[model samples]
Target: MSSTGPLQPLTEGGVKHAIVGTLEQITIALAITVPLGLACAVFLNEVPGGYARFVRTIVEAMTALPSIVAGLFIYATVILILGLEKSGFAAALALSVMMLPIIIRAADVVIRLVPSSLREASYALGAGQWRTVWTVVLPTARSGLTTAVILGTARGIGETSPVLLTAGFTAGLNTNPLSGPQTSLPLATFSLVGSPQPALIARGFGAAALLLALVVLLFVLARAIGGRGPGELSRGQQHRRVLASQRDVVRMSARRPVPEPAAPDPADS
Candidate 1:
């Protein structure tokens, strides 16, 4: 229907605009959420006492906050107060807000699971708190962190209300997220599927299928990249292991007993 149909909405750009808009929203949301979430997680893990607990409680509360609420919050704060136009950035901000709590909580759990002994070992090696966290704690929790990020992405990408409220959907492709309207997959699907025309409905289904495929691809790529945990050696780690083995061999060879008995035996013969 998209190829030969009379529906301009479906066949005009072949849903490329929707695809690009979804990618833009997800990318921008992740870019904002990941570092902030990780930092929050690290802070929560490293800090002790009532303040951390209070913050954790707040984040946990936010985890249950409705997507619509998030959208409204951004709409009021960013769009209304800041006088910013409805664009992909506003949508991204909403999505980021929705994603942040999930990522932070998951990351906190993962970082906490990182053995305390590793942190101790780093400190024993004269590493400071920040250095230990950066080098030891984070790498140890890398796989779990990746999982947290993926989970957040999955949740944010599927949300329609927030994007609809903030993004102000457009049919045409708008690459610049900061200016003009953008239409994500979920928003596009919702808009198209709501149409009275059958061709538009078919295109909506097609857009939904495309969104599903994109999500699957992201999941696969994330798994492939993050499947390896702390126990698995990367290329640099393998090289370092090889170099250490060579050093050990050299040290052992140097410490081996010299052959004074052979000379004595030859002289006796």
Candidate 2:
């Protein structure tokens, strides 16, 4: 339906392929990444001492590692060793590894952001540490954890080099991760932009825009549902305010004066 040249038809196919591939890759990446990332975060957040710092340092370093490095590692280890050809599943695994540190750090930060007083209160109520973390910490910081996972997924979805090297560029739709050439959205854009067709370039732009839209959608959706509710407003801000209010109340009560002795006591003195 586009008269904009040969680029147009090529682009339509590219867009369709990119959208489908990206979605498939993201689904796989999230499934494996979220639970593991959160688990790592829980350990780091709940545990104390120099050990946590060591783990945090490792995660922080991993977060900044280049995408190509992750791709190479996966290619050599999983692809070469397993004798599996480049596939979407491999790409997803590569992306998940790259994404893990981000989600873990984000979730750990959120868990730490939970009020110490809340933990104390839970303990006061005879809750065990594990129970407190499971029931209190997680519920309170659920939104942040969800947002972290979503953000990690969004970050992974845009990966091009990893998908290119691991997933490979294929012309047809592939739903199965275990076999066949699967074309992903980023790889599609990378492949299409090099073409001399203006229509293809436009399609690339549209695809890029769509990818951005998806990321934004996920972030907003996750943030909206994270924490208590959208109506609760900023969870961190609310939590801080509540803490301050409690402190003020405590101070006020501490300052309250006891009743003066009766005049009869003064007469006796």
Candidate 3:
């Protein structure tokens, strides 16, 4: 009897390979997207008038771009035009493109919610526009900005077409984003489920379950990191408060009137 089944791949570390590839794709996507998105949000917030409006409109429009379009764009630009290989990096580029619009639009909204009064206060404190944005506006919108990033992650993570077109599926673990094929969770599951074997289909379901767990884990981690909003005292803030109190105590002690050696002076005299 011949055993021709997808389970053969599972028994040979397929699940682990898929898990690593998925994580790698997301990590790279986030690293590229977050900063760019934040910067776009800040620029849109700081700049006023027609040009900014025009740019914002374009970014907002991009939010509606299809995943396959993004994938094809990356495939064409990076793989074909730039002559780069179809690798995890190319896939990450596609994911980042998909993620960017979501993040930028959401972050712009969050930044806009920051009170004008805060900006005025920052200006009154001698802060420049950029400084005001960096210190006051961004901090005020920290939680919302975190949410924006998470929203982008959610938008990109489950995208099959983009990862499929750009990432190119691989059954083995490939850590190097710049070389060779890497498969994301959705792509991996897609590949596994397409196999004509019940065992492979089961493996695909398992992969899907793992992907869901990964999303939950990411959300939890994001919440942990971005839990505090403006005016909320974090551990660092609490420590600063303690230090300030200690300094006040020291200053008060230093200012206390010292009995001028009056007793000794009188006794000596």
RMSD of each: 3.6, 7.9, 4.3
TM-score for model 3?
Answer: 0.82
Ranking by lDDT: 1, 3, 2
Report the lDDT tens digits of candidate 3 across residue range 66-111.
8899999999999999999889889889999999999999889888
Off by over 4 Å in 2: 1-14, 222-269
Clashing pairs in 3: none
For residue 111, model 1's alpha carbon misses the true position, in angstroms, by: 0.8
Model 2 per-residue lDDT tens digits across residues 39-151: 88989988887998898899999999999999999999988998898888899889998899989988888888888898999999999999998898888887788888888
lDDT of 1 by residue, 16-55 (tens): 8888888898999999999999999999989878999999
- lDDT (Cα) of model 1: 0.88
Question: RMSD in Å for candidate 2, one decimal?
Answer: 7.9
Tell me the deviation in Å of residue 10 in model 2.
6.6
Better of 1 and 3 by TM-score: 1
TM per candidate: 0.85, 0.78, 0.82
